[model samples]
Target: MSEAFTKSMARNIFFGGSLFFFLVFVGLTIHTTRELPERDHRENINEMVVLGKKVWEDNNCIGCHTLLGEGAYFAPELGNVYTRFGNSKEAIKGFIMSRPVNGIPGRRSMPQFNLTEEELEGIAEFLKWTSEVNTANWPPNIQG
Candidate 1:
């Protein structure tokens, strides 16, 4: 009931707040760990998908486009690109293959990567896998 602030009271408040927040952090980490496997659908990963991921990294695709909201904003979000491409791997491949070798005049354009058939297939499979992940309605729209 005393109006004067005391050192013991300040210490208790600081320790109490820290403990509460620490517990909350631990709880959140546990929850994320439990949910990640189900949401990520890791069981779907295959050889092709692995190869595709390697190609993506080698090509620095993230440098231009985003995957799952991570990467540069210069290009489009490719996390759901498989779905956006009408759920057809061929369409995805076609789009990539169709890009002009030289960019458009005074406009942004995706450059042709000259990927082989196998690489194209791998990338398509990887994109398909990403599309199937349970992102909890990420991108908030179909455009992504």
Candidate 2:
């Protein structure tokens, strides 16, 4: 015997699917919460990192640079930049500080933000913090 298609059947199917998806969502949330501490490294976040984040957001740095595989691809991935720069924050600072305001001729270049010394330190520290995040090997290259 073939089952008849009815409103009740439709309603039951909808409710069942909803319940199943809800449970799946809850399970995923729990799993993510459990995994966060191991991955987040929230304990290391400091005032310097906070200021660095502010500087980044204020200047729209993400518009040109990618961090941890996020943001625009116009420039380079800064996720592993600390490691890429020979574990030196000073190198990162120097690169940022040395950018010419008008950019190089015949080539795309980073704009000079004219950041102050404090802001530079803050950004450097922030980059250091970002490099510490567990990205599971992103950027696919040491240079970026």
Candidate 3:
């Protein structure tokens, strides 16, 4: 009831706040651990998807495009590219094959990586798999 701000009062407040925040962090961690498995769509991952991921990494696709909102923002978000391309893997592959739209003054274009057919297929499959993941409506629109 004393008006004086004593050391004990400050210490108690610090410890209490730390405990509360620590508990909150623990709870959030547990919730995320439990929810991620259901949202990640890991069951659909296969050899093609794996290969696609390898191609993506090897080519540094993330250096330009953002996948599920994680990567550089120089290019479009490709998290839902499969859906945006009419849910067709072939369309995705065709677009990738026809890259680096040249002759446009000051227009940014995707560089052609000269990906092999198998790599193309794998990348398309991997993108398709990413599109199926439950991102809670990430990218916010069909344009992505």
Candidate 4:
């Protein structure tokens, strides 16, 4: 081969690299699409779950708690709260309902949000739905 650099060589290198990356991207897309059904967790979605998510967002729960490893860590991880609370929706509801409206003195507490029974149930259902998600063993422990 000649020692001289040429425009054709530069063009070939650029085109070759671009083609290699493009193929890799396409392969990854195909693999993800093929596996997406197994990961189709929308089966857990329901009216109550949707409403619960609404409540979660409306109340700004993320401001204090983490969900699926997102949001603040000031509070406990609620992603697994359903399981952590013994997988009992009633218990979760009760915990929320039992909170003092104005909060307790000298204690970092969750204030009462005055949610209706249905709303409370919805939130519980949402948390339950969240708990069932496969997080690849995230939170790293049962405490989460």
Candidate 5:
């Protein structure tokens, strides 16, 4: 506590701290880059998956439902929906096709999008592809 404060000591401390953090940043960047290919399933992308994503965006499905815990929570979480629906693409398609256009009385219900058969299949394929991604157990529930 009796030591005098010096500019040289202060400059050294600042440089040391900056260098430590810079190295940590670089290390984390490298680690993330190396891990992305393993975590993201780019191999699963196809024409149907792309079309399905386009349909999802066109309808603004995220405005009501959450996907991978990112969207609004007004509806059920769809991050794990493929698994929740018993891993059946037909089941997903059926649910979308069965939505009531007028909605139920005094209850929240998904609106019918009047999707074509091709669009329905595309959406199902997209959901299936999304389910194959490595989320490390996101949602953490079977019912979501």
Candidate 6:
């Protein structure tokens, strides 16, 4: 009811707002930690998946393509590529191996890396693993 501005009122408002936010932050942190494991979707740890991740990094696939909303958007999102390719790792590998080297004119394309069969398979496995991860339905479409 006081019309006059006071330092005590300002101090109380600042402290009250900060305390409310700090409690909110702590509650959210606890909830996230408790829910994380339940939200994890990784079914198994396959050697192929690990190898595929190595292949992906070695080739710098993230340089052009995004995985789970990370990396460049110049290329299609690969997070759900396994699903897009009909859940077949072989199909994914075939698609990658089929690209033309240095790309083709009049078409946005991926260059052929000429990867070995094992490496190609590895990349596919990694992509499959990524697809299985829980991204909360990212990309919002199956095309990703």
lDDT of each: 0.94, 0.88, 0.95, 0.89, 0.89, 0.85
Q: Which digits, one per residue and each the tens of the lDDT, describe model 6 over residues 1-144?
A: 566768889899899999999999999999989877756555565888888888888989999999988999899999999999889998998888888645456768888898999888888878877887776888799997
The candidate that wins on lDDT is 3
lDDT of 3 by residue, 1-144 (tens): 566989999999999999999999999999999999999989889999999999999999999999998999899999999999999999999999999899999999999999999999999999999999999998789977
Q: Rank order by TM-score, top first?
A: 1, 3, 5, 6, 2, 4
Report the C-alpha lDDT of model 5 over 55-102, residue by residue, as the tens digit.
Answer: 999999999998888899888888789999999999999999988646
Span of ten consecutive residues with least summed lDDT in model 1: 100-109
Clash number for each model: 0, 0, 0, 0, 0, 0
Task: Provide the clash count, candidate 2.
Answer: 0
Q: Candidate 1 has which clashing residue pairs, if any?
A: none
Poorest 10 consecutive residues of model 4 by lDDT? 100-109
- Superposed by TM-score, candidate 6 places the C-alpha of residue 74 at a distance from the truth, in angstroms, of 1.0
Show model 1 residue runs off by greater than 4 Å: 101-106
State the local distance difference test value for candidate 1: 0.94
lDDT by residue (16-132, candidate 4, tens digit) is 999999999999999988876656487779999999999999999999999988999788899999999999999999999988646457767788899999999999999998888
Query: Cα RMSD (Å) per model?
Result: 1.7, 2.7, 1.6, 3.3, 2.0, 2.1
- Worst lDDT window (10 residues) for model 2? 100-109
What is the lDDT, from 0 to 100, of the residue 130 in candidate 1? 95
Q: Which ten residues in a row have the lowest lDDT in candidate 6?
A: 36-45
List TM-scores for all candidates, in order: 0.93, 0.81, 0.93, 0.77, 0.88, 0.87
| Error at 121, model 3, angstroms | 0.7
Question: For model 2, how does the per-residue alpha-carbon lDDT over 44-118 read when each residue is reduced to its tens digit?
Answer: 999999999999999999998889878998998888888989989899999999886474577777888999999
| Candidate 1, residue 60: how far the Cα is off, in Å | 0.9
User: Which residue window of length 10 is worst by lDDT in model 5?
Assistant: 100-109
Off by over 4 Å in 6: 1-5, 101-104
Q: What clash pairs does model 4 have? A: none
